[model samples]
Target: MSLTIKNLSFSYPDKAVLKNISLSNLPKGKLTVLLGPNAAGKSTFFRSLAGLVDADYEQILINDESLSELTAAERTQRVCYMPQIFSTQAMLTVFEVVLLAQKQLNSWSVTEEDVQSVDALLKQFEIEHLAQRYISELSGGQQQLVSICQAMARSAELFLLDEPTSALDLRHQLQVMQRLKDETQQRDVITIIALHDLSLAARFADNILLMKDGKLQGHGETEFMFSSPLIEDIYGIEIELFRNSKGSLVVTSELK
Candidate 1:
C-alpha cells in the first residue's frame, strides 16, 4: 500500500491552513512521523486524509486509487483516523465500544473472533482489566488507549493517529509507540502519526515529515531528516542530539 499527494491546499475563508503541500509516495510497512509545532497544519492534513476537510486541489492516491473519489463508507473501510481530542463520557464499556467499531466495518452480530480480538488488543496495551469498565469511569490516559484500540480494530490499510500518546505517562508512551511499530510492520499498514515529541519520533519513525508554516520543510529517512539545524529551523529552538548510556538518541533543547 502507498499514499501519494500532490498540490494539496486548504483554506478556512479567513486564512489558509495548508499551502500547496505535496508529499511523494508514502509506502506501507513503515511508521511515518509528522512533526511540527502547534497550529502548523498537521492535524488539518490528517483531517483531509480522513475525508473530514475539503481540499482545494488534492490528488490523494491510495494504492493507485483516488482517495477523493471514494465514498464515505469506502473511505472508512480503507482508512482509520484517530483524532487528538475525544470525549470519554460514553456509558459503554471498553469492549462494547471496540465491538461497535468492528461492527461498523464487519458484521453486526458479535462473533467469537471479535470478542477474542478485542480481548487480545486490550491485553497488548496492558489494559485488559478495563475491558468491562465503563468508558466514563476511565481516566484520560485509559480512554486514549481505548480509543487507539477502537481504531486498530478496524484494521484499515492506512492508520492516521494524531497525538496518540499525548495523555499517557512515560511507560505507556513507550509501550504505545512500540506496539504501533510492531502492528504497522506486521499488518503492512501505512501508519502516519502526528507527534510533538521529537525524541520519540526519532526513535520509532522509519521516516519523518517536518512541517512549518503550513508547508513541508523536509521529508526523508529519520536519520537524514533529524538534524539539529532542521529541528532548530522547524521548532525555532536550538537543539542537540546525543547518545545516552543505552545508545538511544536523546534530543535536548538548548536555550539561547
Candidate 2:
C-alpha cells in the first residue's frame, strides 16, 4: 500500500497553512517521521490526512483510491490518527478505551479474541498494570502511552501520529518508537509520525518528511535527508553529522 498527495493545500481565514504540498508514493511497512519547526503545519498535514480538516488537493490517494471519497466510517476503518493532545476526562479504564477503539473500527460484538487483543496490546506497551486504572488518574506519560495503545488497537491501513512521544520520558520514548517501527513493519501499514527530536527521528525513521512555514522542505530516506546543508537550511543553524560506533546517524547543532 502507498499514499499519494498531489497539490495539497489548506488555509484558515487569517492565513494559509499548507501551500500546494505534494508528496508521491509514500510506501507502507516503513516508519516516516515528519519534522518541522513550530507552526510548520506538520499537525495540519496529519489532520488533513485524517480528514479532521478541510483541504484542497488534486488527489489524496491510498493505493490509487481517493481518500477524499471515503465515507466517515470507511475513513475511520482505514485511517488511524492519534493527535498530540488526548482526552483524559473519560472515566474509563485503559483497557476499555483500547477495546472500544477496536470495536468501533471493526464490530460492536465483543469477542474473546478482542479481549485478548487488548490485553496483548497493554502488555506490549508494558502498561498491563494500568489496565484497571482510570484514564483520568494516570500520569501524562502514562496517558500518552494509553492513547497510543488506543491507536494501535485499530486495524488501519494508514497511521498518523502527532508528537506521540512529547509526554514520554527517555526510556518510554525509545520504547514507543521501537514498538511503532515494529508494528509498522509487521502490519505492513503506512505510519507517519510528527516528532521534534531530531536524534530520535534519525535513529528510528526509515524516511523523513521535513516541513517549514506550512511547506514541505524535504523528503527522502533518512541518511539522504539528514545532510548538513539541508539541516542548516531548514532550521537556520549550524549542524554536524557523524556516525557513532554503532553506525547510527548523530546530529549536533549550534546557533549560526
Candidate 3:
C-alpha cells in the first residue's frame, strides 16, 4: 500500500496553512520522516490526513481509494494520529487507557484477552511496570509511550505521529523510533512521522519529506534529501553530512 496526496490544500478564513500540497507513492513498510521548521503546517497536514481537518481539495488516496470517501468511523479504523501532546488529567490507569482505546468505552468489562494484549504491548515498549500507574502521574515521555500503546491497540493501518520523540530522553527516543521502524516493517504499515531531529530522521527514515512554509520542498530517499543545500534551505543552517565508520549518515554543524 502507498499513500498518495494530490493537489491537497487546507486553509482558514484568514490565511492558508497548506498550499497545493502533492505527494505521491509513499510506500508502505517504511517510516517516512516529515521534516520542516516550526509552523510549517506539519501537524495540520497530519490532521488533514486523519480527517480531523477539512481540506480544500479531496485528493488524498490510500492504495488507490480516496480517503475523502471514507466515513469518520472508517477513517478512525484506518488512521491513527498521535498529537504532539495529550491531556493527562483523566483519572485512568495506563492499562485502562489501552483497554478503552480498543473498546472505546463501549463495554464496561475488560476481557482477559484485552489485558493480555495490553500487557504484551506495554512490555514491547518496556513500560509494563507502569501499567497500573495513573497516566497523569507518569512523565511526559512515559505518557507518550502509552499513547503509542493505545494506538497499537486500535490496530490502525496508517500512523501519523507528530514529534513523537519530542519529550523523550536520548534512550527512549532511540527506543521509540526503533520500535516504530520495526513495527512498520513487520506489519507492512505506513508510518509517517513529523520530526525536527535531522540526525534521527536520517538514521531511521526510509524516505524523507521536507516541508517549509506549508509547501513540500523535497521528497525522496534519505540519502538524496539530506543534501547540504536542502538542509540549509529548510533550516537556514549550514551543516555537513558524511558517512560514519559504520556506513550510517552522520549530520553535524560544526567544522572539524
Candidate 4:
C-alpha cells in the first residue's frame, strides 16, 4: 500500500502555507523523514494526507483510492496522524483518554479487542500505572507520551507523526523512535515522521525528504546529505558532519 500526493497545496484565510507541492507514492515498509524548520508546512502536509486539512481531492491519494473516497472514520483507521496540537483538559484520566481513542475504532461501540490494545499500548509506553491518573494531572512530557500512545494505538498502516519526540527526554525520545522503527519493519507499515534531530533522522529513516518554505529541497537516501551545501540550504545554518570514534555520524553547528 502506497500513498500518492500530487500538487497538494493549502492556505489559511490570511496566509498561504503550501505552494505547488507534489510527492509520489512512498513505498510500503520504509521510514521517511519530512525535514523542515518551523512553519515550513510540515504539519500542514501531514494533515493533507489525513484529510483533516482541506485540499484539492485530485492531489491526495492513499493506496490507489483518492483520499476523497474514505470516510472520516475510514481515514482515521488507515492513517494515524499525531497532530502538532493536542490538549486533553476534559478531566479524563490517562486510561480514560486512551479508551477514548479505542472508541474511535468503531463509531457506535467499543470492543474488547480495543480495550486490550489500549492496555497493551499503555504498558508499552511504561505508563500502565499512570493509567488511572488524570490527564490534567500528568506532566507536560507525560501527557505528550500518553497522547502519542493513543495515536499509535490506532491500527493504521500509514503513520504520520509531527515531531513526536519534542516533549520526550533524550532516553524516551530514543525509545519512541526505536519502537516506531521496529514496529514499522515488523508490520511493513508506511511511516512518515517529521524530526529536527538530524542524528536521529540519520540513524533510522530510510528516506529523507527535506523541505524549505513549503517546497521540497531534497529527497533521497539517508546518506545523501553529507555535504554542507544541502544542509545549509534547508537549515540556513553552517553545519559540520563528523564520525565519532565509534563511527556514528555527529552533526554540529559550524561557527562563523
Candidate 5:
C-alpha cells in the first residue's frame, strides 16, 4: 500500500526540476502535501506520476506492483491526477459538468447507475441545488466546488490534487480541505496535494514533502517540516509555528 519512487529525476526543455529524488516508501492513507516555491518542480513531480512527462530515471511502484508495465488506461484508472485547475467551456449544467468527469461514461447519455454516483458526489459538496446551473455562469469558488465533486467521482485509490483550494475563500478553503481529508480517510485513498498555503498544509496534511530548487529537501510529519529555520529558508521569510488548543499547527510570520 504505497507509491515508491527510486532515484526519480526529471526536467523541462532547458532545465531540471527534480534531481535524483529518491523516496523509498511514501506512507499510504495520508494527505501528503508537496510544498515548494514557484518553478520549484512540484508541478513537474506531480505530473510525472501519471507519465505526463518523461522521467529520465525512475521506478514507479504502486501497491508493490511496478507501473512500468501498466498501460495508459490502466494507469489513469488506478491513479487519478487533478491538475492545478480545470477549465470547461461547454454550455453544460453543474450536473452535466460533473458527469463529463466520469470520462468512463458519456456526458449526455448517463445510465441510472452513473446518475446515482454523480448525484451523490454533487450532494457531497452541498451543490446538488445547482444541478441545473451552467458551470461557466457560476462564480470562481462555485466552479471550484463543482470541480472537486468531479474529481471525487473518479474514485481512484490515489487522488493527486494540485492547488485544490487555490481559488477558495478562507472558509471554503478549510471546508474543502477538511472534506478532502474525510473523503480520503473514509475510502482509504492516498492523497498527494500540491499546496502553497503553509498554514493550511500544517493544519490538514498528515505528512509534508518539502521541495526547494527542484530537490526534496525533507519529508516527514507536518510539525517536523515546519521548523523555524526550514520555513524561513524555504520561503525566504521568517515564520513562527505554534499549537492551537485544538492541537493543530498554527503558522505565524516571525519578524527577522
Candidate 6:
C-alpha cells in the first residue's frame, strides 16, 4: 500500500499555494517527513490530503484507490489527521477524548476493545497518569500528547501529523517520533509528518519531501534529500550536515 499524488495544485482567491506538485510511490510502513520553511504550504498540503481543502489534483491514490472517490466518512476511516493547532477546550477527560476518537465513526455504544485501545494508547504515550484529567487543565505539551493519543486511537491506513513535536520537550519529542515510527512499521501504515527540525527528520524519516514556495523542491531518501543544495536554497541559510560519532545525521545552520 503506497501513496501517489499527481499534479496537485491549490489556490486562495488572491494567492496560489500549491503548483502542480507531484510525488509517487510513497511506500507504506515508513515515516515520511515533509520539510520546508514557514509559509511553504506544508500545512496546506496536509489539509489537501485530509480532504479539508478543495485542491485540484489529477489523482491522489492509496493502494491504487482514488482518494477523491471516497466519501467523507470513508476518507475519515482511512486517514487520521492531527493538525498543528488543536483545541483544548473540550470538557472531556483525557481518556474520554481518546475513546471518542476510537468510536468516532461508530455507533454511540462503546466496546470493550475501544476501551482497551484507548488505554493502550495513553499508556504508550506515557500519559496514563493524566487519563482522568480534563484536556482544558493540562499543559501545552500534555495536551499535545493527548491529541496524539486521540489520533492514534483511530483505525486508519494513513497518518498525517503537522508539527507534532512543536510543543514537546526534547525527551518527549524523541519519544513521540520513536513511537510513531514503531507504530507505522508495526501497522504497515503510511505516516507523513511535517517538521521543521532537520536533525529530527534525518534521524527518523525514511523519505524526505521538500517544499518551497508551494512547489516540490525535492523528494527522496533522507541522505539524498539532505545532501541536496536545495536544503539551503529553500531555507535561505548556510547549513552543515554530518553524521555524528553515533552515526546519526546532524544538521547545523547559520544565517546566510
The C-alpha stretches of model 1 lying farther than 4 A from their native spots are: 105-107
- Sort every candidate by TM-score, greatest first: 6, 2, 1, 3, 5, 4
Which candidate should be chosen as best, given lDDT against the real structure?
6
lDDT of each: 0.87, 0.91, 0.87, 0.80, 0.83, 0.92
Tell me which residue pairs clash in candidate 3: none
Candidates' RMSD to native: 1.4, 1.3, 1.8, 2.0, 1.9, 1.0
Top-TM-score candidate index: 6
In model 6, which regions exceed 4 Å deviation? Answer: none
Per residue, candidate 6 scores C-alpha lDDT tens digits across 69-144 of 9999999899899999978788989988898888985898888988888888888999999999999999999999
Q: Select the stronger candidate by TM-score from 3 and 5.
A: 3
Candidate 2 residue-wise lDDT, 138-217, digit = tens: 99999999999989998889999999999999999999999999999999999999999988998999999999999998
**lDDT comparing candidate 1 with the true structure:** 0.87
Point out the worst 10-residue segment of candidate 5 by lDDT: 101-110
Task: Give one digit per residue, the lDDT tens place, for model 3 in 42-161.
Answer: 999999888888887758877677887889888888898888888999889998898888875557888898888888889998899998899999998899989888877777788999
Cα lDDT of model 6 overall? 0.92
Tens digit per residue, CA lDDT, model 5, 15-94: 88889887766777778888888988888888888779878666878878787888887888878888876675767999
Model 1, 155-248: lDDT tens digits are 6888999999999999999999999999999999899999999889878899998888788888898877776378687787877777789877
TM-score for predicted model 1 compared with the true structure: 0.95
Q: How well does candidate 5 match the true structure, expressed as C-alpha RMSD? A: 1.9
Which runs in model 4 stand beyond 4 Å of their true positions?
A: 105-110, 226-228, 245-247
Candidate 5 global TM-score: 0.93
